[model samples]
Target: MDSKIVLITGGSSGIGKAIGIYLTKKGFTVYGTTRNLKKYPDFTEFQLLEMDVREPQSVNRAIDVLLEKENRLDVLVNNAGVGITGPLEETPNKEILNAFDINFIGPLNVIKSVLPQMRRQGSGLIINITSIAGYMGLPYRGIYSATKGALELITESLRMEIKDFGITCTCLAPGDFATNIAAGRYHAPVNNDSPYKESYGKTLNTIDQDVDKGGDPEEVAKKVLQIINTKNPKVHYKVGALLQKFSIVLKKVLPDTWYEQLLLNHSKK
Candidate 1:
């Protein structure tokens, strides 16, 4: 194909939107997935298609729409996910399930749906958006970290499984970034009776502060472009400030107690 086709989930805004625009400018036909078509108007640069990653049928339908026109998929980016903050005890089971549905299972659905086409094409790229939190637990956001960690593990095994078919699976672990996800994050209600009320509020405040001062989304888009251009991309790509990126390294080099203390100190507002 003259134009390589790219499908990126959660493309309504944030990093996903930026990535779609960047790839489109690079001469690739980009298809972006959004749950709500009304929210995102027509983009001169790329096409926005309706997709709910949480539903297998919806994911398949969205990919089918692209396959019908593009004929082949060169890249599939699983960037659609949700965030949550709450003490495990205080957080409802429903909220936790919803988070996993969107963050973990949602990507799984897309990956499984797109594999058949990619296999037939004989080559493709699957990029899963993970987080530094995946490397270590983020207290109030423990479930979110678990979801990312799970995705990271899956991508690793998936790469090993699909390498023979000329398909590549990579995980992109990013730190805080300037995005609209903060305002929409799921936060459990903390009342006076809750034991973790004060701590949860403090930890969440610290996390929010980092997000407020996070890196630009354009940087992330640039990194995605770099990955796409590489002939052989690594299984894991980390993008963010040195301070945050280094934390993953530090986690490996430091003792367990030291690492825990570091996280505790950093998360305390």
Candidate 2:
């Protein structure tokens, strides 16, 4: 563990930065990627490389730089993502695509760039930081949920496909955590003229409040460390408030309509 090499995307801030800092203190050589290095000129927790997950060439270049220096990448954490919320009908097509590009395709690009090196190492772990919301569709967060939910399914398939190559892939879905996500997410403006004005506006406030009152990001960092130490990790793991994690279970056992109503009631609060 002292010599493990780890790469975490979006490591400049939020959950990614927390994880990188924790791992570095635990004796791991951690490198995190950021879209803009200048924004974090004061970031000293770990080294930050420049990379745009939406661009394959940029992703490759950043990983190449890491590989050339460390010669091995023992872990890859797909923690880079952006949140989007709106009524599907009201959301712009371009915003929807941008959400998927950054939250879904972006991670895929990073994974594709990192896989060859992991394959050569004959041992590696890929942990995707998804969201508990991914397990269900909330009223205004359908697009964000879809992006994370898609990544969860992809991780399931990826694990089996790469098992023979001595590599492992898994998803860790976190519930609301106090972070900069709410500040950075693309929120479709509340249109006073739109039909969803009342409901969408209320739901948007609830979403932001949840994030504001969320748990510390270090909780997620600790979970990542646990996953790294485990010899055989599960296909999916979740860390969040009890009610939030229970929501996934509710979705599984409750009738579809009943679960829908439960979410509706919760959101209205």
Candidate 3:
């Protein structure tokens, strides 16, 4: 069998970087893409490509170059994303659009760019790195959650649509992982003595505390490897600490009033 070729977006850092390293060690040819390649440099086991997923032209051109060089693509991992933190009302419209572009539309661009090749091959995998926030809403992160929700829906529809083409679409919804996501560039609406300022302050503090308790990104990358190697991959893969599991289960089983209260209590802290 030929070595599996994998393309990972946002592979310069975080879970994407870990996944690239893990897959390379497993003898797969990994191609990692990012806007900035200097940070990652060149690696013997993997090739780094520059791509801006938000731009359709950039996405298409990158995919073209990958295909021209490798002649085939076996797996694509859409992991590039940005987080916007603030109350819904306090988030500017452009910031919300940027979040959607990076988190949702970006993946769509990559997927569309790669689908024809995967279909021609008659077998391939596309893994979308969603978040626990994709499944459940969090305080002061409505915009981010909305983007994930959009991805969740896209993954579901793609899974159903591409099965006949021997393509698999899996959604990897992880809980809080120890990553630079929070520290990454963020744009919050100017607070002009907003009424929600107090609530937003408390919510931000809670986010900081939770991130301190988040899981390791490398561990999450291991899970991605397992999913790729599995004979029958599931559509949804959830990973996190016990609290994350509980939160997901509670959101599903608890009454609306109860869940709302739970969210309120957490936000206040």
Candidate 4:
């Protein structure tokens, strides 16, 4: 069998880079997308294409290039996203829209661009890279959570919609993974006079610390491979520390108020 061709958006760094490297090593032909192709003159783990997920034209062009070269696309990893942190009330409308555009709408653009070819091939796998924070509303990171959560639900709908076309869609929600996401993350300034200053400041610090101490992104890459190899993949999969994965379970069984309190307690820590 010919090697599977995999395209990973946002593949220049972080979890995306890890996945591309792992897949390449496993004998899959990989293409990773970055907005600016010139930034990484030395990216050799896989082929890199220029694509900004937020733009449909750019997405289509990149896919066209890949399809022209490979003639078939077997896998698409919707991994391009941005992180946003701020008190909901304090975050600017533009910033909120920008976050949604990059995190939610961006993936949609890429998915739409690739679907026609995938349908033509009658078999394709799309793995959406979501977040554990998306499972619940984090205090300061509500917008980011909302974006991932939306993608999670969208993936569910997409899976059902495209199943007839022999297309599979699933979401992988990663908990704090040590990555450069923080550096590119949008943070509404914590103002001296703002009402949410204290609590928001603390929560922001905690968020960063978690990322700083987060797990290796290669774990997520491994899980992606596992899902790809599975005969029938589940709609949702999570990769993170034991406690982080357990939080989803806790959300299932605990009382609403109790779970809320648990989150409050954790945030206050």
Overall lDDT per candidate, in order of appearance? 0.90, 0.94, 0.87, 0.94
Q: Rank the candidates by lDDT, best first.
A: 4, 2, 1, 3
What is the Cα-based lDDT of residue 222 in candidate 4? 100
Residues 186-264, candidate 3, lDDT per residue (tens digit)?
A: 7464376988878788788778777777888877788888998998899888888878777888998999889989988
At residue 248, candidate 1 shows an lDDT of 90
Q: Write the per-residue lDDT of candidate 1 for residues 215-242, one digit (tens) a residue.
A: 8888888999899889999989999999
State how far residue 147 of model 2 sits from its true place (Å): 0.2
What pairs collide in candidate 4? none
lDDT of 4 by residue, 1-269 (tens): 79999999999999999999999999999999999999999989999999999889999999999999999999999999998999899899999999999899999999999999999999999999999988998788889999999999999999999999999999999998999999999999999999998888888888889999999999999999999999889999999999999999999999999999999888867
Candidate 3 global Cα RMSD: 1.7
- Candidate 4 ranges beyond 4 A from true positions: none
TM-scores for all candidates: the values are: 0.97, 0.98, 0.94, 0.99
Give the lDDT of residue 157 in candidate 1. Answer: 96
lDDT of 3: 0.87
